[model samples]
Target chain A: MVAVATPPRGAKRKAKAPTAFGGYWRRNQLKLAPWLFLAPGAFFFALYVVAPILQSFQISLYEWDGLGTREYVGLRNYEELWWDDAFWTALRNNVVWLVLYLLAIPGGLFIALFLNQTVRGIRIYKSLFFFPFVISQVVVGLVFAWFYDPTFGLFNEILGVFGLGPVAVLGDPDYVTYGIIAAGLWPQTAYCMILYLTGLNAVDPEQIEAGRLDGAKGWRMLWYVVLPQLRPATFIAFVVTIIGALRSFDLVSVMTAGGPFGESRVLAYYMFEVALSEYGFRMGYGAAIAVVLFAIMMIYIAFFLTKMYRDEKGV
Target chain B: MPSITKTRLLAFAAATMLAGAAMPAIAQDEPLTGELRIFLDTSNPAPRAAMEGMIARFQEMHPDLDIETTIIDREAYKTQLRNFLSANAPDVATWHAGNRMAPYVEAGLLEDVSDLWDEEVSRDLASTKGSMTIDGKQWGVPYTYYQWGVYYREDLFEQYGIAEPATWDEFKAACQTLLDNDVKCVSIGTKFLWTAAGWFDYVNLRTNGYEFHMDLTAGRVPWTDERVRQTFANWRELIDMGAYIDNHTSYSWQEALPFMVQGDAAMYLMGNFVVAPLREAGLTDDQIGFFQFPSIDADLPMAEEAPTDTFHIPAQAQNKEAARAFLRYVVDAENQSIINAELGQLPVNSQATIEDDEFLNAGFEMLSSAQGLSQFFDRDAPAEMAKAGMEGFQEFMVRPDNLDAILERLERVRQRVY
Candidate 1:
């Protein structure tokens, strides 16, 4: 002290101490701060969302009618699925749905690129393109149904102008699923287009200039420069499109109801039909179907999570 | 320095807490009041409107009680009803009778309305009490009972020189006559699976007696029995003779009504509800007429499908007394008349006057004179069996080539249920 503490090497001067409560908060903030902010939301999420999911999982193993003693059926529900051809057909259709629904991405990107411009009335065109997404899927399904009506629908009427015979799009089993998928893609494509337009606005002009100097233009420019920058947008678009495809219930229900002899059934509609429809209340069996679907979804989710983890680590 | 101000703040907080503690007591001394909730399946406009009118009247009667009602479509009704019942059930709700009510009844979710039925419903009427009674105890009070049979166009029948067939052979001949006349013999909408179930029940019931039909539905009879085989054989005969419409799976019952109304189809096997749409299509009562389903066996008695609509009070209902009072009031002759007048349904109460509406009168007559009444196929059969049986019927109708496989699959389903 007499020697002025010798001004020890790399030593700093002491600052004023914080208050007791503030000091405690600062010391533990990394651990406690997150919980403090998340407490209310976590409480609600646990009560309404997480709890019900767990409850559903528990209910899946028991034979219950939403009441009475829930008899534990173990794997019998899954065993029944072994021979359930309809379940297989529905699963196959869902696979088809997941594959075909990806077309919405490119289709949406193309539309987005086409509409992303400074042309006159471009805003109105964008708004018009977004109209279908704003309307309820139920209404869209009804409109599409009327449009596909063989006898008097607008599509057939247009065909009639070209001297082609009427085609029963909904009535033909082979074409019914495609018809429903087309209707779904209408709104899905609109959604994707909006996403891409936003992604395009955030593109780095400097990077584009560098690419141009490097002789990158047209498809080459898009592939190496524009698309890499649009990764976040494409990621979000892919996730939403996958979820939408997996949950394609409304259009199928409204337009065909998995009908034409159950040819249009996908997993979501088929599960509801088996579980709660007038047909039967096979809750356990329905749960088995749901679990299978969840497992398939989990595979995609794992892949997505791995990619996100690598990106987060700055790989 | 701030200690004095802190004391003043504490005093203010204590005063506010005391006021909050006293507020509930002051309000409780005023009145007893709360909300009453009801849910209904609103597929048809007439019944929905009639129900709304009834609810409005109820609200007017009980001004202090706030009533909330939720009307859902037919497809969503089952899922929503199950959820509501499990979580927070309504005071009263509309549900189908027979096997459809069995699961809920078995779970003890539905309140026992036997006391109300016995005290309020007049037993003088034959059909009123019978439809709602299950296991010698009443679980619900039926408001309407409808008859199911062949609704044919008299103009088409007359033009084709065919009369209403009394037997299966005659019915086939009538179909042949209609086909020869270039009119579709029967218009069916199998797209809604329940429509095809009507044909299955008619054939099965006509071939077998009511008791046998019940046994078959209750999983007591093997589906491989000769009676079952014979029913399919009879159905096969009709299919081979081209007795039904082309592309039946593509149409709904409402869509098919036009074919019958326009005389493009000779017959439509459906419930009495078809009259509503027929009238909407500008068909007069004389143009559309009803006939009992033709008998498949000469020896067995004819039993027609008569599905009933009933209301049940939930077991956990807080307003049980009020719900019972409402039930008693609605089943009374005055309310029955209002219901029948608006809904064009047959009144369960025999004393209720049939409106001058010709369709209602015909439905009343058909329901009153039927030898026996069986609940519709889907209602009479357990839910699982009904689904398989109905799908098999649809498949057979579309591809008669798969009759054996269809029958075998049905037998397997029937066996599983037993």
Candidate 2:
């Protein structure tokens, strides 16, 4: 901003003058300032995120084995994906994940409401409730896996008390994906709870008090006054939970590795299994799978961005 | 390919001359240099300790050479090799033998190590050569492998007055007798589909002999072939008898061991690597005993499942010489003996011998005398086909009545994958 204000230092040589540096700096400084600030983040974003995405699209068109010469097979990889049963299973599982994952929002709000009251040891209770979110997803998956174990797990043990036989939740293809998603929900619900709790704290007590004066309390007060104020938090919660569902990789990976005949597969895990695993590296095929996942994420991202844009314009 | 072969041969000959002029210990004269990065999965404590010991010894030998090792969880390790091997490839990596290595070999990720095999491995390690060879060339050097057979609870058998079956009829009858007395006849964990493949390999190899099994695994034969159907038919009979531990699919191979250990179930058809876990589960040597998988189709030659592990230099590695040195050092019978001793597994090198433990003796005998050794099903078949085949196998185990449907589905996968 001050490049124009500073005079050139007493010129020693005419051509070697400081005018060039200052002139360029002054003329472009404002225009370049924001970009200069964004450079590091933009550079990384382009390098890691953008480049790999374009590369994945490119790789999907070829029969490349990660190494060696790539054969340009055009849409053959995508063509194969059309008939791929595992792809369908994974896609269906992802849809199920998305639909079920939204439960976290209401679930979180309910939890936040339950713990929102001024009770003794509430802070401790909040932290304890948010404990699952604090732990890594890998650990949560393992813990849940142990809980769901057929012979020795607590779930089965609990069932035994009811004179019910053990349930092989992880091993049965019918229940495997749901079993993993339930585990995913444990942590996800915790995360949404934290978001709602903070959102709840920022809620206007005056509006709540006004609502209470009109006989609004419990669910009605929360719906009419409290929730509207928590819109930003709800929006963030929805976005993250959707992403968590789509990126439902770790839980499936840690708990199942897409087992029981690929019944538990999400697109991400299926891609890994196809391109890597003990299977031959059909990188092109894997890339095709990734491209499909990216396409899906793009739809969500587009929807999210458009919704946010409209909200921003309105506000 | 010829042009590459010529250039590689020249480089290899130059390397050999350098080796000859150097000290007998390759690294001592060359003062080994460059990074020798090895990615392996040794999540099992014994094997992990054995690998660490091996690497420590390797470091002591080539103190000047920088070494990097990444040991990953076994399952995760399976998913990352293709990624790393393609980009910033490591100098050395561990891989399985048989059709499992075919994709990497075909994609040229693994260096052709036939020269190293001839110079160091082929003579003493002939038994393992078949597993490592692809298109008449060796892809890697196998260091360790163990036998797969019936691991039974001897105490349970004795208590129930059941004799160890040696023939197919006796095996079936034994399952019937055990079921009549309320004991699950077999304990298997098919949670990781490959464990189901273990059962498939034994049944296929026993019913159809090793050649047909290999053909089937190689995708040369259709899954609906009469022989394959017959194998499943036999498997169905066992399934119908409720011979296997219930809900086998819900447990990993390790998870299934508890039933056998607790004497609630009697037998496990598993690789000998499970010995460690079984012992960890508190079953003593006397309580746990092994028998060869019972013979079926008496005219068919006997074969055993022995999946071997190998080390290979990636084709793009910068440290070929150092990696070659590692391969040579690792395949040496003495080193193999030391490593496998700690691993509680048998070394692939012929001259490498295990101590006189009863199980080891039985395992060695079982593998050695077999007419052919089939790498367990997952290792024998291309990963894609193996995966589909095993899934079908597992599904069939659950619903034996779906035999035709399962075979048809497997045929579709085999057609596409092969």
Candidate 3:
């Protein structure tokens, strides 16, 4: 619209200097305004996010010990990662986390439905369900570590009532990853429950009533009417849960530190272990792991964005 | 390297001239006039106080020198060292001995301090010189070291009619007796993994002797070597007997103390540091006792594990003269005695007097008479190899059947690491 109203460039320059510049500004302000506002944020975004990402890629191609001179050994870090057993172990654990972490969505919806009713002391119950989410992930990790302790845990006591002997859940490599994930799921489920609870508050009662009249109740009502209305909430929950699963560092760190022979390592924790931990000084190898993790997140986000774009177009 | 050596030579010549000019106060002929920054990781209550006190005393001697000190949490300091050493270097920094200092030396982050190790200092601190030396030059000065051996429940051993084992067969026999009576022979926590390496170090040092053990840690010997397997085979006997407490991997070294304190386990193979905690937990001096790790081979001379803590000056430091004085003051026998008395540890200087604590005396005696002293596994080996080796040790303790696989995995890591 502004371009059509603007005079040709040479004709504008021939006018009075002050008026000509003012005229140019007036003509292009609409197009320039949004970009002008976005410049600061975009500059910082490039500096902090994009620049580091590119640097990580460059660093992954060299061999650096964080203290010594960087020797360029192109693709060697990545090549070593191919045969690295610890890398594979971490990758496998990440997949397990991703798959199991999604269970929180349904787990949350069920809890939300159970607590959605209006009853005396219902707020108390809702607050209690939300308590785990409010606490720090570090606290959650500590609580769960004690809960799964081999000698004196409540879990073992509960098992002892059934005459089963104690089991060292954290010490056993076969159960270490699962043990940490279950600890992770405690807070994640609470977080999702809060999301669903808010989504439930916004749910339209009229549509629910209409569905009931059409013989849709229980699971049917939820699937066809209630869930469709909660799509936005569900979408947010899915995105956060996936990210939480992928970025599962604190729980594994606080609970296990990728112990029992690195059986419980997620890629995030493994990268930290390889790059910065007391024994870890391999900066290039750590960068390679970071690059791989970044690639994974990029592919997932790209696919998600494309679907979201198409969905918006359809809408 | 040449520039550093030339600087050292110049400083030494200047010191000699100053000493000749003023014979009365030779050490202080050149009055120090600069800022000296020291970063310490003695964040624990006792050690922190000890270090602060030591620095304060040093500050008193040179009132004109501006001394700044920073104390970081012990674990956090391990990772922060590289950042500070390269970016914002202090004049003096605390670090470990042996291969733990290798990376810094190799990267030229640490200054060469061999000139400070004069004839008297060398003779007094001879035991730790091997640990502090990388290549032919010394990079740091050891202030303190402590022995690693079996700290056991004396009452429990006496109650079970068991004597302190002096030989391998007697050790097994005692473990068997303890096991028969439903007591775990040893209480070890391998959760952090390095505790497992402690066991590995003692066993390897005992079975194959010090040279082979050092070779193995240096990655000169393959993990799959027969001597290495022999060490593991000796360790397996204890493992097969269920000598160590069950589920050891679930607890940290501190967490394993309850077994010995409560008389559930007979022994704990740990450092001299364990004695302090055991006493604090209400175990009497009579109840807790120290013993050398029993001899595994009659023919091999005994070696001991004694990890030393040392201080180094950064190569990039601005105040080398003041820093050298601080290090020299640090290793003075009297300073070592004063600090180690408060530290409940052994002084690195032979002339220093030890506290009259029973366990400390025992450790001092054992370490003094030892043919060789090894810095514990994590300190001796490269960090990557130490990590992989310790993880394998923990795995082996839990599942002895996995020994072959663990050894092969360690071999792969060693090949890559070296």
lDDT tens digits, residue span A1-315, model 2: 699866676544544656888779768999989999999999999999999999999989988766578899999889889977779999999999999999999999899989999999999999999999999999999999999988789999999999996888988878888899899999899999999999988998888788989999878877788889999999999999999999888899888888777789999999987786666478899999999999999999999999999999998
Q: What is the TM-score of each candidate against the true structure?
A: 0.85, 0.86, 0.91
Whose DockQ is greatest here?
Answer: 3
Q: Chain B alone, model 3: TM-score?
A: 0.89
Query: How would the candidate models be sorted by TM-score, starting from the highest?
Result: 3, 2, 1
- State candidate 3's TM-score: 0.91
Which stretches in model 2 have alpha-carbon errors above 4 Å?
A1-43, B1-40, B49-71, B83-92, B117-121, B315-326, B329-342, B352-354
User: Which pairs clash (backbone N, Cα, C closer than 3 Å) in model 3?
Assistant: none
Report the candidate with higher DockQ, 2 versus 3: 3
Model 3 lDDT per residue over B1-418, tens place = 2433343465445445544543332365667765677889998777898999999999999897778787887877887888778865778999999999999999999999999999999999988888889889999999999999998989989999999999889999999999999999999988899999999999999999999988998899999999999999999999999999988888988899998999889999998878877888999999988899999998999999999999999997767788899999999999999999888899999999999999899998898799888998999899999999998998899888999988999999999999
Candidate 1's error at A158, in angstroms? Answer: 3.8
Candidate 2 has a TM-score of 0.86
**CAPRI class of candidate 2:** medium
Q: What is the DockQ of each candidate?
A: 0.42, 0.49, 0.62
Ranking by lDDT: 3, 2, 1
